[model samples]
Target: MPIRAGEWLAHGSQPEWTMTVVEKTQGAPRDAGPLAELDDHGLVAACLAGRRDAFDLLVDRHKRSVYLLCYRFVGTHEDASDLSQDVFLRAYRGLRRFRGDSSFATWLYRIGVNVCLNRVSMRQPLQRSLDEMPNLAAPQADPAVALVRREEARRVRAAVARLPRKQRTALILRVYHDLPHKEIASALGTSVGAVKANFFHALANLKKLLAADTRSGS
Candidate 1:
């Protein structure tokens, strides 16, 4: 019962659309009571036991955060949506290898970070700013204020993008995703101290970039 391309509506509340898509794709039962009550570990066990809908439950639970993380990395709705789907697909394929060394969320985040980095590496230089991307404003906000906000967001994103790869990843995970240092270290496959150092340098570099942008009257 996956939603067909023609059946998908572009206009609607985001959460509503996301749930509709998840329900359709997973074909989850209407009585998802027990499945929904199980924790991540339980759901993972169910998925391994051939309960494909259990995996869909995971998707429904985590999709919003995953989408937001992808959006932060790519700064566009379309790319983020595609990347989020890719993350879940990759997670599904790799489920057998999941050893429970970290939380499921952390493990999934590691996959997402790797996928985004690979995508970024393969793309042209990030010449597009956040303002030029999408979804930085409310529907009825003042146009002038929204423009200013977009410009500021664009400047910050540009600065973050210019950091060394590790630093950039650390900053995005820490600030944008609000992951703890230990969780971030697990995701990046680095030590906690290293993650801290990367975040420190990222902040320093961001300050300098923002200052420069301000001075240049951008």
Candidate 2:
């Protein structure tokens, strides 16, 4: 059962969505060093030395954040899972090129942003069906109140998805990921000033979109 490059790993309910296994390295330890004991740099170095398990560890550590970031852009668990897997595959293939100019997380975020932007650009703007919308209800909350909140949140997500690519990326990195302006700029490959501008404009556009939705409902 050796996984080969370009093979798919089925994830979740999306049987059509597959994560590619970019390369299989020899001499990778079956039971390698405890990944929790190593820093990113250490794991990366181990991976370079043909320890495949190190990369698995790296994936385990960052996959949640990466998946959440993907979900913010695509607005579906299936698409986000697909994109997140793609991000990791790209990261694995590009590991040797990493020069440590930034933290590994920042570098990974940059890759994820690029992958998402490319995918987003090739398709029509994302629109979530009611079934695709997230359930944002709290236990014991009134059903009516929860429904209203969920609808509002969905509107906001839709508004964000409709933003210009750069603005959307900047806003997601800053607001959702809680990344600072400098880190966001690093992730987006832009200047700090530019990141701030994009965030400002994204918020302004979201306000307009949401307000229009509210006014129409009144």
Candidate 3:
């Protein structure tokens, strides 16, 4: 999923909440100037100083990753898009609270994880899997092989989703995002030891879940 700048949240089907928040904080458009060269922290400073375009650049840099994280949790484009937008909206409102203790991306990930967990808690478990099987299968691949692989992938995803919250989050960050334990600890607001423990337990539990599924022929 290639996320174009200003396109995902601008879709007509997006929730009304994002529109209100954007209208309130969005500054007038201007030329990129030198702001494009800035790092995340520099961009944050620029945004706080009223350079709204700086925030736009930050969005362009991180939105795809954020959307993917949300998609992994929710298993659908619509819900992921909504949750992604909500995460950014919260980040924008809480910009002042971003104390440079972690990298901007890590801070954003924390916000994204919290938003995803809250959304997941309020809804029933997702039965649909991510729309990524097409990418996994080659154009000329056997249909039966592709079907089997897709089903396996779906079951794996469902199993991951069912893990306890900390375990699930730790696994996703470490495996999918490739974040180191130290960085994951920062995003999760825990120590590295705790993150490692959760990750180990997550892998153990996931293996058991998959083995059970295989036994049941599900």
Residue 144 of model 3 has an lDDT of 78
Tell me which of candidates 1 and 2 scores higher on lDDT: 2
Candidate 3 residue lDDT tens string, 86-191: 9999999999899888999999999999999999999955575445433652542686777777787788888898899999999989998899999999998899
What's the TM for model 3?
A: 0.80
Candidate 3, which ten residues in sequence have the lowest lDDT sum?
A: 19-28
Global Cα lDDT for candidate 1: 0.83
Runs of candidate 1 with Cα error greater than 4 angstroms are: 1-29, 125-141
The total of clashing pairs for model 2 equals 0
Predicted candidate 1 versus true structure: per-residue lDDT over 1-218, tens digit per residue? 55545455567424433432444434344667689889888899999999888998999888888998887777667888999999999999999988998989999999998988888888834467544665644653687777777777788877777777898899999998899999999988889999999999999999998899899984
Segments of candidate 3 deviating more than 4 angstroms: 1-30, 129-140
Q: After superposition, how far is residue 79 of candidate 1 from its true place, in Å?
A: 1.1
Error of 2 at 62 (Å): 0.5
lDDT of 2 by residue, 1-218 (tens): 44533354345334544455545544333465576588889899999999888998888778889999998888788889999999999999999998888889999999999998888888754576766666653543687776677787788888898899989999999999999999998877779999999999999999998898889879
Instruction: Go through the candidates in order and give each one's C-alpha lDDT.
Output: 0.83, 0.84, 0.85
